[model samples]
Target: MSQTDSYDDTYTESQVIMTTVKIIAPFTLTYGMFMSLHGADTPGGSFQGGAIIGVTVLMLAFAFGIEPTRQWLKNSFVVGLVTGGVTIFIATGLATMALGGSFLEYDAFSETFGIAHYWGMEAIEVGGVALIVAGVVITLFFATAAGFTPERNRREDEPLEGVSDDD
Candidate 1:
């Protein structure tokens, strides 16, 4: 069976890459979480936090190896990335329409959920952030991995008829 690696393994064996990735991942994860949990109370929120998590994933892939990272990349992941954002956006819009207000009226959610408008808006904003982070991070990791692999390289010089370059 082929073993998959973690995103942090991009720099796996190298001492510098390993050390930096190790240190950065924890810090970024913590910071991201902090931002996410207190999104309503601060400048940073779930989106920023999600991006932080995404960054950690990217660093892990760099520190560890790509083979390990494949496990995290799933069909659901692609769907989730797009769906999460769209879900939040659509929900917000629908809420506004139902409430007879603008497209993203926070008043609708606030009233529906029995929360303050500020809170509703914050939730919507944060959710949007989450989707953005997921999509970006996943896409970036795949791109990075491709950059290092031979198969990822679309060499125009290679002959289509199985002819050798030296021929």
Candidate 2:
């Protein structure tokens, strides 16, 4: 095949990869959200959810191809980490201040929100869980991607080079 033909063939391969990623991303994101949302009331919570979501992106890259996976990871991974964490922290702080209490203390916010102090604490706990989860996911994902060794690159790029004929 000409160089152009080889390049064109990559498009087809990438399309297949993207199709698989599309199938998987929504389930992963939704599961993560569910875990975060019900963290206070359930067995599973933010840390598990965040890790699950981050792994899905990693899996997509692994199964489909790196380019599409990298795009997805690069696009929203940092945003998710920062926005989720900052939002939770700010909201908790503001709620505490509004309730005339110390930072992240929910007792005052309970009065402000007209909910029980217990419920307020629950909300804070959930937010904390989510922030922790997201932060870890972002940290791990970036670390893994950044430290991708030359061996990994060769394995992914060549696909067949590492295999032995004895197999």
Candidate 3:
């Protein structure tokens, strides 16, 4: 209501929000990691765990403005994370195929999905789902908050690198 109360360079009103997030974020993040790590032994799996981790990132964005979060996590880096996650999943499927099994048929490795210390599950669940979720959630937050139009325009106006405009 007052000029002093307005959002300024430092975001004075954020002190409380920042403090709360600082205190809670670590615990939530740790819990999320736990969920991801222990999912094989518990009820939840990558989906729930990934959502938790993604929520932590969202909470961070809320505490600190989207701009700061975006600056901290470049879009390229997040894209890499997403790409890596998908690659893990695809590689897992391919690995099974290479072993004369159906896609993601972990039972081929062992009677149970525990062969090789559950490496297959770990790759698909943790590497694929968790990373993808974390990257995508943060990327979505940044893109939506900062407006994805400029990116759309840039892509439409300019051809991709290494590709000719004539194509």
> Local distance difference test, per candidate?
0.71, 0.67, 0.79
Q: How much is the lDDT of residue 13 in candidate 1? A: 80
Among these predicted structures, which one has the highest TM-score? 3
Better TM-score candidate (2, 3): 3
Q: Rank order by TM-score, top first?
A: 3, 1, 2
Which of 1 and 3 is ahead in TM-score? Answer: 3
TM-score of each: 0.68, 0.61, 0.74
- Candidate 2 positional error at 125, Å: 4.6
lDDT of 1: 0.71
Candidate 1 positional error at 122, Å? 2.3
Q: Which stretches of candidate 2 lie over 4 Å from their true place?
A: 1-24, 75-80, 122-128, 148-167
User: What digit string (tens of lDDT, one per residue) describes model 1 on residues 1-167?
Assistant: 22344355323388988888888788888887788767678887777777887777777776677656666666477568768877887887777888877887878766667777786566566677666676777677677666664334648766544446787
**On lDDT, who's better, 1 or 3?**
3
lDDT of 2 by residue, 1-167 (tens): 43235223242356766787788789888888788777667898766776776677676656665566566666465666656776776787787887789877777855677777666655555666665666566566656655654565675556454566687
